[model samples]
Target: MGLRTIGGWLQEQHVQLHMGRWLLELDDARAEREFTSYDDVRGLAEGRFALYIGIALTLAYGVVDVLVLDELQLDVSLVRLAVVLLFACAVVVTGRAIWVGRHLQVSSVVLLTVVLLMLGTTLGRAADFPTEYLTTSCTVTLFGAIGLLRLRMHAVLVMAGVYSAVCLSLPGALQGVDALARNVAPTLGLAAIAVVIGFSLEKLRRTDYLRQREVEAEQARSDELLHNVLPAPIARRLRTEPGAIADSAPEVSVLFSDIVGFTPVSEALAPEELVQLLDTMFREFDELCEARGIEKIKTVGDAYMAVAGLPEPDPDHAASLAELALDMQRTLARLSPAWPSPIAMRIGIASGPVVAGVIGRRRFTYDLWGDTVNTASRMESHGRPHRIQVSAATHALLESRYTFSDPQVVDVKGKGPMTTYFLLGSNL
Candidate 1:
């Protein structure tokens, strides 16, 4: 084969073996966005693994230092001192790793410590000692420290290159071509393997980090959806216990408003137009409720339902709901002229004890039950167009603070004759 073709094939093999493309050449911005959670996981791993690796390296290199001195019979004080200094550095690195385990800079610090150790050990080698022995030690130290520290691939590559250069050039500077040639191939091969391993490790970490972020984002969306469907407190309870979530609110103001003459309007307008009208009016009602701190319940056809002092208690619930009903009436009056026919709402409000909860597992809904809700519905059905009807219980709460018509007896469904009033406007 031609040299060019052979070289190309070998390069391709190297690319495939090392996971194609250089480490840290990924779209770092995109990776940072998608793989932010990776920092936490990597920091934890570094914090936990750093101390152990540091201790182990200290012991391993200390033994090698003693053996080299004894066997080579070169009892150089500087060599012994370098060995001691390296061990002491390891101790400091281990302690620092433990202390700053949760920090992002720990990885960089650990890698730098390993590089310094490699430099010290190499410099302390006996003059007559074989370059091959030091080469093997440095190779294993560089690669092993990286794997154990779980350093970032880019940082690993940079440090590994610098360390490799130092180790390789030592023999070339000291003993010329023969020594350089002996260690060059083995060093390159080991460095190539280190690159593959580092890249593979980072890839795995990135995969896991992205998956965790995706899961967390999905969970947040789910929680938000649940809260939109139900009250925040009720949704929280349902999540904690997958069962019926019911509560008895002793004093809540329930308001039910229906667009007056809805039947004629529905028949006159197109389906989309009718729907748009209802949506527009109800959206106004929703805003009114939100402004007044009221909890809007489900809307049926052209009717809107809402309540106050629910999911959370409010002593001024009656007043707040009354304000909401007034705003809704004013809102419709201002916007009704744009519709095919002028719109008017018959609003009813009742204040009393009621049972509220979410029902059904498939399509859970926050709803209310009890006489208060039924009575409120009845007042709306029996109300006059453009008028706000209120039950005796509700009137009692607002009578002192708001203007209301004199008591009028209305026969409500499932309830005997009851006193009701028309809420005019707030006295305040």
Candidate 2:
């Protein structure tokens, strides 16, 4: 019914799809919506307008050819019939040009040019003598020059130059004064307009391309950041579902770890040295969390918080937490010799129902906000250095898979005396 419900069903069935592969194509489509360059817009508009003009000119030329031939009382023959057939073909070509305007592709301009050239050639052949030929030639050359301008500047100039040469040479062939003068002014004027329009259109296209690229690059960066921070499903939901918050549903296991004497250690070392040490340790910790499919919430001073069932739920949350706690202890032990001071860590893990959600209005953080979070923090504070402490709830869930030693009932501040245990090793 809905995208999220469909996605949930797919996930439940263990189906995986390469949805991210379509991101680039979607981004390109979005980029097309914004105008990046003035030149591109102008080029697109001009080309479309020129196509419509070509259609109108084609119709006008067809009507004028028939009327002029009829007014002259020209003998109707097979040759005249052929000219009519050519005019019918030109009409079809013009209809195609009108259809192509919707796409505004450069190839459409090329097609229109071909059509105009064919019409011009047919008209030239149909004229009786050199005088009639010169008149038809001048009119055809003007239309051809304008049509060629719709494509590119170089193409337009080339077509205009060839047409101009033919028109100038026509007067000599016909020995007419009016035909010679008609060739010069109109040809030069049309050539200037074509050059200006072509260059302007090219500039617009380049500007539009650059702007679109910028928008696409920005959007890609944002998507990458979102993926890095939130789980794929959560991120996608946040984007598509309005006012969706990270929901806390079933029981989840939360773990917190802190160096026993981090504050004193910080006092002894320089600021930069302390930062370097923390950076190295946290970087490794992050890697381990990722390897174990655990989510690192955040670090506050010396305390590091992580969760086992979040963004997505896992029934093996307690086992996962146990594995993480053991790994953390081993990792800290290995790094002790390299540190300025012997670093000892205490880990507290608890599995229970917690209200977890992204908190804050501006700089938000995904955090658990329930008595379960409080109990976990207390467990960490009460834990012995170099040992993992588990609450009764966690112990119950993990007792079957893990061997834990019963620790004496400890006086936990607000919660009073609570039973705790030390995680030894996994049963398997």
Candidate 3:
């Protein structure tokens, strides 16, 4: 196989501990893709400025060529103008759809070497001054390699090899043995300096990239936890304001469900069993809530609370909550065989304007206040096992769409006798 193909394949692999240092890389494909994405964006601004500076220097050198008395000045000017215009076009078109990256760095080094070789061929040949410009050419190539281009080791090596090969061969072809020997030491010394600077800069850049990835991952985890603690809308408001968020939802339905006879059942079972039971049942309730367009409010002990139409307004908030409550009953019936005791639930729903917001500085909770919340809780406490009791307001909203038993008057605490109904099933 060709040496260039082998070298290309080697550069694509992540090589660690290469001649002692400077080969910082990731072995995993996912991490490599992530780093490539980061490197592409990071190199864009740096490479663009470097490109601008290179273009300016090329134009200035073309002017200097005209000032010098040489027969090849016209040839040199045309070459310089062509190189400058090519890079100038890169300046205009870059950062639009196309971009600059490691390849840009490699191209810059190769093109700079090409310009020097072209100049040396046209002017340095046949001049009485032997190998005087070779040292300066090596230095200029190193400047673009380390300072202007900031190339990685592989690309820097390519630049060094091309220049060294030219210095070794052409001095004999153009000058003599003495000229080849004179340029050798300077070429190698400058190449060493370029590679060293490139290594250190790249090592530091890789370190920073890893650190940034870690910080972003941490922020994502923290955001996920925060979103779980509160509703997305409430959490966003809390982040922007970082204060007490008190929002009055004009019309929302609240559902409070409690496991019937769970207190005595908890006494009979082991702590682990009790917790498993609650987790299994509540997890199912959570799924039902999500499926039925309900936002889960915090659960207290064996009780599960949910709301609809608060964070985002749902026009049929009461009807949606009604559907969720019935789903909870059906879910419990399906799960009854595995339970330690015969499982039943009492769910109460109410619809009205309520004050809802995040409360407490530590262990923040999204809670509800006002008569509607109290009425819902009271309806659940007064409710019968295996039945869904709802307030008059909720019944008013769902009456057209649902089947309810006869309205009955019940004495509820914190309020006088109130009219309530039992949600049986859907009309169809």
Candidate 4:
């Protein structure tokens, strides 16, 4: 094999690896959407690239030696050639192990052993005499063993150990040391150098793996947190769209529920206990919202806010909001006993156009802004406990499907006196 042939083979391998990576990206996209288990596919693709690159580089060196060093010749005969060929076959077999999706440990061991044997045989053939051969073999074996250890391949370590011992004992077997001392010393030194290099490489590899794992774990935690705070559809949209902010979302129904006399009740309990109680109540509220297919906007102190439009809107936003408020009132009534301090709830339902989205660069929250959210909050604040209040806008939308008490004119903080109605119950 000449340099040109080796370079061509390497270039071909690079092209193949690049093509495989490109195809793998397409496969990855499809797998992400359709397959539940994608790690296996990803692992196989990565392993294939690693093996392809490793073999190409290793063979390129061999090709360089064969082509550039014309004077260099191995004393080994047909048997040695057959052994080398067998070792090469082993490399290919081990490389294919990734496709089987089996134990990487077993495959690594087999491959490491073959590589060691090949290196040992090549070095042995280059030695001038038995003593020299022993020295050179020991040096190569020791260093190669260290490299294998760095690679974290147990099988390679075993091969290195055996090879090192053979090299050290070669002089004794040949019954000549004085003549081979010069070559032996140099071989031992080279082996020691290889061990140092292997140590450094292994440390770097471990550090890289640790960093990669940390990044992946952090990303998973962030994803989990995002899903916890936002509805699936909204979260997905926010992720796909950069710098997402809610524009003028049209005719979305908003629901606001606040615990009546929650301030006094919260004062009665410890801060931690108050938070715990709130968390329990809110978690339940979240489940109810999800069950009713409502997108939660945000929570303020003791109040729960939610919406039913934008980021995949539903036409029956008013009806859904009405139904959800009724369910929540009923559910909270049953859960009153679980709270450290007994409390009742006042829920307000309203339908109107409003802008809702994540705001703030730091400590951000998905919230609704505009008069609609404030008016809905005021309705809850002024509402009687155990009742659901509805703005005229919301009442009009649900008037056909839900029964409501006659319009009650109420004074609100920001929006003066407004006509609101009590949602009696669902007509359905």
* lDDT values for all models: 0.71, 0.64, 0.73, 0.63
lDDT of 4 by residue, 179-293 (tens): 3565455545554555456545544543444344445555666766887777666677777888766768878888889888887887788999888878887888888878877
Best by TM-score: 3
lDDT of 1: 0.71
How close is every model to the real structure, measured as TM-score?
Answer: 0.81, 0.66, 0.86, 0.64
**Residue-wise lDDT of candidate 3 within 1-428, one digit each (tens)?**
22222122234443222343444455554565556556656565566786687678777766655455444455566766776776676666556635345456555665656755654554455332235554464356456646555565666667667666655444443356665456667667766776777777777766676565555555665776898888888888988996589989989999999988888889998999888978998899888877876899988998988999978899999989999998899999998888877978999999999998888989989988888889999989999999999999999998998999999999998798999999999996
Candidate 4, poorest ten consecutive residues by summed lDDT: 17-26
Superposed model 2: Cα runs more than 4 Å off: 1-113, 127-180, 219-246, 291-293, 406-408
**What is the alpha-carbon lDDT of model 4 when measured against the actual structure?**
0.63
Q: Write the per-residue lDDT of candidate 1 for residues 100-150, one digit (tens) a residue.
A: 444444455455545544443455354444566566656666676566666
| Per-residue error (Å), model 2, residue 267 | 1.3
Backbone clash count for every predicted candidate, in the order shown: 0, 4, 0, 0
Q: Runs in model 3 with CA error above 4 Å?
A: 1-22, 66-72, 96-138, 145-150, 166-178
What tens-digit string does per-residue lDDT give for candidate 2 at 1-428?
Answer: 22223223333343322224211111233232332233334545555455455555555555565665654323323333444454455445545655433443344435544444444443445454343444354455345434443344445555556555554444243356765565566656655665565555544554445545455555666766776666666667767877637676578888999999888899998999888888878888888888888888888877899888886788898898899889888889888887778889999988888876665656656677777788888889999999899999999998888999966698999999999998999989
Name the regions of candidate 1 deviating beyond 4 angstroms: 1-41, 71-114, 117-122, 125-133, 148-150, 171-178
lDDT for residue 171 in candidate 1, whole number 0-100: 44
Candidate no. 3 TM-score: 0.86
Give the lDDT of residue 247 in candidate 2: 76
TM-score, predicted candidate 1 vs. hidden true structure: 0.81
User: 2 or 3: which has the higher TM-score?
Assistant: 3
- At residue 42, candidate 2 shows an lDDT of 51
